[model samples]
Target: MEYPDSEAQLPLPTLESKPEAQITKLPTRPRTVFKNQLVDSTKSSGSAGLANKKCRARSLWYALYLPQLSNLDPSQQEKYLNQLAGLMQSVSSTVSFHPQALICEIRSSLKYFAGIDVIHQKLQLLLEEQLQQWGLLDGFLYAASPTVTGSLLLAKSGHNTLVYQKDNLRSALGGLCTDVLDLDKEQRRRLHNMGVRYLRDIWRLPSNGLCKRFGSNFVNQLNKALGKAPEPTCNYIAPPIFITSYELPYELENLDRLLPIADEILAQLCDFLRRRDLSTSHLHFSLLHEKRDHTEIHIGLRQASRSQQHLMLLLETHFNRLTIPAPVIAVRVEVKNFDAFFGHSNSLLETNSLDATHYKDSKLIQFIEELQARLGEDHVKYVSCAAQHCPEHANMQLDYRGSSKPRLKKSSAGSISRNPRPLWLLQDPVRLNINKGRLFHRRVISIISGPERIETHWWSGADVRRDYYVAKELKGSRLWIYREKGGERGWYLHGIFA
Candidate 1:
């Protein structure tokens, strides 16, 4: 059909005007499989449909560059990097960091935030507040692209471009200056001598020529920027530990003066655990003094906890017992041993409730912890029965942090024995004088039950062979006496029955 001149001048219907259903109903095309696809794609002019499909399959990386970060000290740099990484988690789950830059994968977060634009707006607002708080008046630079290196290159080049599709990446990055490549002086001179001033000029050259001239490393970097090669990423993971330090305005020798500073650090640790739903059972405090000396204090809990009030109480107890050798110039707190926090059932029940067994256990743990803090941790001990026949090896002593219930192992002699044993054993057996074939201690002793022989550890160099008997003293007191079988062959008092 032929149209009039005026009608012919009218604009044609555009793809943007197509209905959603119509677009969905269109036939799908098979994906193209190219040999040396990474290289071939860079050389070919592909269709937009293929590009959109490729882009949808790849992750979108957003790079943030803070120029002021380089001027900050290493500690300050790490602090700001952590702060920015935490903020970026609101927009994306996958975040990676460089010296002064942060790269996050936004493709997965796009659906949650509705679109890339909304994500950008939310992040921009958050970043503005953070920058203001940090006193970074110079602000920052950012860019989004299909590849990590591409986004970083664009961000560092100050382009602030956002290219979502892999197909458009080449042209979008073509105009950037060669300096963004971070070339060495020699490399830059060579590029200049070769009249390669822009990235596009380098792209126009043959891959083999560039590899031979600039080395394969530079060529690989270019490929990574254009989405031709994959780049490895080190995603950020929040550490399980919390470490914070405070510098006092002046050295203070009084222990009471340090409580406030310690309280502040404890509060921060509690907040850190609360946000992560974690609890810690171990804490370390360092009191830095003059002359590069430090006093270290360690706190151990019977149960994992994150209560700031309880921590302060423990800290106060430690402070009461501590003797400051020198004035403290700073205080540093560290907590390692983190555990997943679960709401305690006992916490929801009354202390008197029959089901509040855990509450009673917690009370016991708290008491033990208090004692540990008051006395040194080494002074507090837990005694448990061991699995040995010898009295010396039958029981063991452990630190206060050991299990409340002893794990008993059955011995070859069985769980129960016919022989009656004394409740108390002496450190060293006392020799008894034999008077007319009778044993005598402070007073005369008579055998109540016959001898029970015990012989063990024959394989060891130090062997023990003895015959023990339950005896009674002249005053009606119970006595445990033993007679050596091989060596000494004399009667001795070993223990007393309670």
Candidate 2:
């Protein structure tokens, strides 16, 4: 009848809606049964250690980016990585009412890895492998929990995970030490003296008395763990601005030589922060060299301060480790931090805006460009250091911002104390003649003096000297002259050979 009712058309599939962004941090209350359960579970299983790896859980973190880690300058690398760690640390401090300690949306990663857990596992593995190669084994971990919040909750709960899923969470937490409840040290001891050493003991206590004894925070954590109260989750503020770097002259393969260059560019960026009296929170590095392998490193500052020295130390440590290939072609560094100055005072150092004389980064940018021109980028350097004991090694050479560099030190050929330095030491020395205080450039020498002089490299067999007298010629020019054995004395241009 009437086409089986007008409303009876076939149903079409509609796509399900998904969250717009990944949940970056998760908050899980680690109280009662679930708390101790996580502890025993972790110690009983080997995977507990695996979970500690930073990349192991989803709700706690999102996409893990290992950029062209090899190409960045070390300073940037350290800052970047350390910042990541600090942010994760921040998650561990979430309030008890916070839900899901960490939540990294797997909507996209799920597409590539099969499932959210798989994606999380992959990232954790990546970090573990890389950190191992970098010789960093301590103070890092990643794990899974029944809820994204629980995993993060378990992290700061104590260095272990006794349980992971919602059902297992309670039993896993029963044995957890009371100290994991995010209480101050004094509060922890107070709980201890009150016979609430285990999370279960605290969980079983009367809520009204618990709150009265330890304040509302303790009761609040219990409520969140028991799913009675809502745990607020706050996303970390995404950086509004960031800066990065790259090195050219890709062929500069030596680590010793490259360290200075890396340091210099990073310093320039740090100096840029000084203009605004700003300090950065995070910095990262990528080292892209030859060979297929690349490396990325990072560092984070607890308090924002534009401290060049602090940042540099972290960078140098990582850089010093690299087993650089024969020749590296380039390096890159990125700074991922927002602008934060000490105060809003109007001093020149306190401003983040640019001025007429120079923009914040104008001078450094110009310097780098000009340096690339003359030194061909490859030969030019960004960093400098004092040379060593050898006169030839006195000062490390940096790219030109100033004066001409003297290529040579003192004579290695002679032991002469006063440095029988030529008026103009030449790559190719030209012998000269002198007679009675007049140079014989245009004529012959008229006088020879009693031999008195200095010589060098006697053991090494190089020898030369003379009772050099002021030389004269028909032209009347002064000359540096030395006598030879025979009667025939030859004269050649020396000082002004050019």
Candidate 3:
């Protein structure tokens, strides 16, 4: 009675759940079929099963593409790419460049940078700052994938996707347009005729057919993008030569006035070396004079270094000994020799000891450089050992800047005798007077270590046959005395030991 009946009180059906008779079905058009049909991905013959496998260490690569670089000339493009490569070295040791892209292996760097996400954040910020400094308007696009070609293709297509896993690389690259591939006009036309608009469309075609029509190289390139084949790349190596010049507002003859300019140039060079992780042991400075030949100054370091303070100190030493020949209108600095920089790590336990050692070594080198600059390179010499058996020919003096390095020639026999040798050898061996079997340098001396027989130089006309002994004087001074075997058969004082 309450409602004419519970069934009669039911609500009317909505559009979602309408009665079959009330709903009308619309007629649909037939599906459009292109000339080529999409093949089954599972049956892909060329790179079959590659997308399902995991990427090896060498497979993970990151690519950055700068569209603005294409607008530059080839030389300018190379220079810019080199600069960018140096900057990228901070994140990855292996960096390579393409026509408009920079690619690096990131698998080894992921842990150091925390992860791919962190690396992306850091590189994005770094690149943005660099581009801004360069006055580039259009920003760069980047992609991380399992294959270099895959990452490059994704980046070039303006898709900033990151696919770190191999399993996701193919799918990530599938949607990219076919034009991203390096194709000739004829190849592009053929692809368009085949209705292959995207990479996935090409993948759909039979591999054998694609190989026969497009050639094996093209097919192999696609396979590389899918991690089926390895991609070989030449790493970008910055040129060893670093040259910078500064023009002075006015000509100056005094070296003191010219030093600030040199300092500025050296600062720039050190920054360049730091960015590239390089060091140079030799530097050339030119003092430019208007309408005259420039004065050249050369500075040499005992070891490779990039420290501005050290380099400037050497430069100052050279300037102290130098006299400006003419008024300098400009200054030029050049460095050609480069070496990899290896920074020393400090020890927590032996920090003081290491600091002392480093300080002592640095002071020694500084002293040598200053002496060489003041006394001339030839006058400042270092004694080095040689391979000759004769005592006179056993040691030679070498200049700091000499072309001849202290390298001993390979001896066919085993190493020379381990017997002690004196550091101070006389230019002429003084004939020692032997009285009652006692060797005398200035006073009577007693033999401490014996009579080691040395008979060598027989091959040469001047044969050496002597019995050498270490004798000590009354004052505790050690003398190296040798008794001749032939000729005069006399005793001679050859060397002295400190």
Candidate 4:
């Protein structure tokens, strides 16, 4: 120490040697990655660099504040928030819902949408469309900021401004009244008495004095608004199954009156599914009766879909067959079986090809669905080949509600038969009188084809053994006749072929 120069001999300042009353300066806002751009607070920049930095960070966030939403009751607010959340999910996957506002991180959506301006415009259009649809176009405020807290505060203060840089955040927050700060009544009174009417006045004070005079919470919130601290948020996740109900204004018995309500519900349900890129194969519609009883209708679709018009048409078909037992007070729609939507490309050539195929399939399915809806599901049936060789057991009838795929395999006995089978089969074979060793029905039948033998189900107790023949009636009508091989040797009529 004695050999050191006067400047070097001076004691180095230490944290403990500083006076307790000394005001420690607030830490500078740390460099952050915002909207794919790095912003460093410590770096001094010219006007152009600062302007460029501000532009780069502006796309980081979007805050949506619905002041009217805060006035709604908890349930209504929750429902509105859910609808808003669904709409916001179409804009960005990362959406956080506050009690009074919604914050979306749109940095990841820039590439897909082209740029921040385009995204902003698209979001504004979508939000406006939804608001107009819901009849809530007023008191909706929107802003952009690099930090969630900054954006939220700006939205809360009803400032539809975009804070694009850290420097911009200070000026933006500074313009707001001190009431925007999360301070107690006493603390606010003290601040007001001290002439700190604006956030800028508080910002000008030493951090240590402010903390000592007020509390740490005010300072912490201020830091969060300025992007100097982390702002934790809980993201909103959509429900897997979409179910909603509406109470009718009056008890209704007519199907025509219910159609409009059903249409609206289907529209909302389709919107929910489309936003999540989902389609439902099954939907349940329940009608709450005034007598506290409910009638539930289950709708099954041949193809999963998220189209509101298509769903409403299906519902109308079902409703046509429905007979109300009581006046309905409410209606609920529940969607349980949802699958990811497989959307087709909209190219002209591909759409033409797909449309042709889709039209055919849809037409067939629609016909079957209409038939089942009108006549009962059990009444509409499809015939499928059974795994049996006996003429009576060669095929079975299946419910038409199922997909048209082969359900039974052909038996080895049936598959090996070289003789052609009849298109129609009798429920039970009618005995043909054998007159002088020739088969006799209304007219004597002549054998056009010799016997093709079929024997099956020997392992089971019920066994069959027969020689089948394609016989021609005298009038040129073909008949499928078979004779029992072991018992009675009686000839029987089994089928006919035209």
| Candidate that scores best on TM-score | 1
Candidate ordering by lDDT (highest first): 1, 3, 4, 2
By TM-score rank, best first, the candidates go 1, 4, 3, 2
lDDT per residue as tens, model 2, 128-186: 66556665442343344444444455555554453433445666666667655667988
Q: Give the per-residue lDDT digits (tens) of candidate 4, residues 1-498.
A: 021112232343242332111111112222343445644322222342456544554435789888767667888877887778777877676778787788898765666676567777777777778777777754478787778888888887878886656667898889888876666889888988999888888788999998898778878888988888888777776667666667766778898888877887787778777867899889999999976678999988766778787778878888888888999987877787788896654565445876667667876776676676667778987787655566677677877665656555546445634568888887889899978977799898999986898888778877788899999999867999998898798899999996
Q: Compare candidates 2 and 4 on TM-score and give the better one.
A: 4
RMSD for each of the candidates: 19.5, 16.8, 23.9, 24.3
What lDDT would each prediction earn against the true structure?
Answer: 0.77, 0.47, 0.76, 0.74
Identify the superior model by lDDT, candidate 1 or candidate 4: 1
TM-score of 3: 0.43
lDDT of 2 at 180: 55
Candidate 4 Cα deviation (angstroms), residue 28: 31
TM-scores for candidates 1 onward, in order: 0.53, 0.38, 0.43, 0.48
Q: On residues 1-36, what C-alpha lDDT tens digit does candidate 3 reach at each position?
A: 111112242243342331111111111212122112
Candidate 4 residue runs with Cα over 4 Å from true position: 1-239, 348-363, 379-388, 396-404, 407-416, 434-446, 474-476
Where does candidate 1 have its weakest 10-residue lDDT segment? Answer: 18-27
lDDT measured at residue 219 in model 4 versus the true structure, 0 to 100: 82
